[model samples]
Target: MAIGDAQVDAADLETVAQQLGRTPRGTRAIASRCPSGHPNVVQTNPRLPDGTPFPTMFYLTCPKLNSLVSTLEGSGLMKEQTERLAEDPELAAAYQRAHESYLAERDAIESLGTQVTAGGMPSRVKCLHVHVAHALAKGPGVNPFGDEALALLREQALWPAGDCSAS
Candidate 1:
């Protein structure tokens, strides 16, 4: 699997489309991969072909990871992280940095004309999926809350990294 940069091939796009139940719009490249060499994360364009403002730069396309994140959200994990953000200074700072990094990446792709990055970054943790995608795309130490959330999933044996690709 390519570690950081992966050209979004037709097979990869097809795989992501199947996983998501629809063709992804504005997909620029695969940002990360699963252990079995399938794409797990993708970097999207700020603007779609239809000129829609798609601010979400990095997106997770792996069905297994998406399911795990959905389960975490169903379990009130997002709320817990939001509360923790208000309480932990270091974590809040790191999350803010993640927000900045996300903006920089998106800006590098196209001027999106908005400061609001995905996953309720810098202020709240509304979407764990986006944060997890960011962490997977940018790697660890970039998104602290994402790393923590992924750690929680791993701790609970909920992470489906390698097994999904086998299927």
Candidate 2:
């Protein structure tokens, strides 16, 4: 489910903390949830509470999804996607748009005065976890790499197999 920057309550924060194994800093809202209605993606503040510049606006918090995305990253998918970005102009354009969109959303919340978006966007694929989180939070077609990663996960039968809520 898309939570979309709505006010997060104590239970949600507690769940996010459990998922991260620490208290989440600068969490503005629960961005998205898994099939079991547990927060899988969170919309974070552009600048963290401690005055740190946080470029990652969308963060994936689901352990199951994190593990699966890590598997994809370990398989050198990032390198392949990065290479494709150099060769495919259309893809590069789409990815640029995604980066711009991410920046606009984050800047709307709080401008960090930087063009750097998360997950090596518009140029390379650095983290599938971030990409997947972006796709999950914004839905498909927003981020090409993100959409591709989600599709690959689904094709591999590694996504939506069951509830991913923390026990």
Q: Point to the candidate with the largest TM-score.
A: 2
Q: Whole-model Cα lDDT per candidate?
A: 0.84, 0.88
What lDDT tens digits, residue by residue, belong to model 1 across residues 1-167? 23124356888888888878898888888888887778888888888888999888888888888888888889998898899988989989998999998998888877878898998988998888898999988889999877987898889877754568655
* lDDT computed for candidate 1: 0.84
Regions of model 1 farther than 4 Å from truth: 1-6, 165-167
> In model 2, what is the error at residue 67, expressed in angstroms?
0.2
Candidate 2 per-residue lDDT over residues 48-140, each given as its tens digit: 878899888999999998998898899999999999988989999999999999999988988999899999987888888889999999998
Top-lDDT structure, candidate number: 2
Q: Any residue pairs clashing in model 1, and if so which?
A: none
Q: After superposition, how far is residue 131 of candidate 2 from its true place, in Å?
A: 0.9
Candidate 1: residue 112 lDDT (0-100): 76
Taking every candidate in turn, the Cα RMSD to the unseen true structure, in Å, is 3.2, 2.8
Clashes of 2: 0
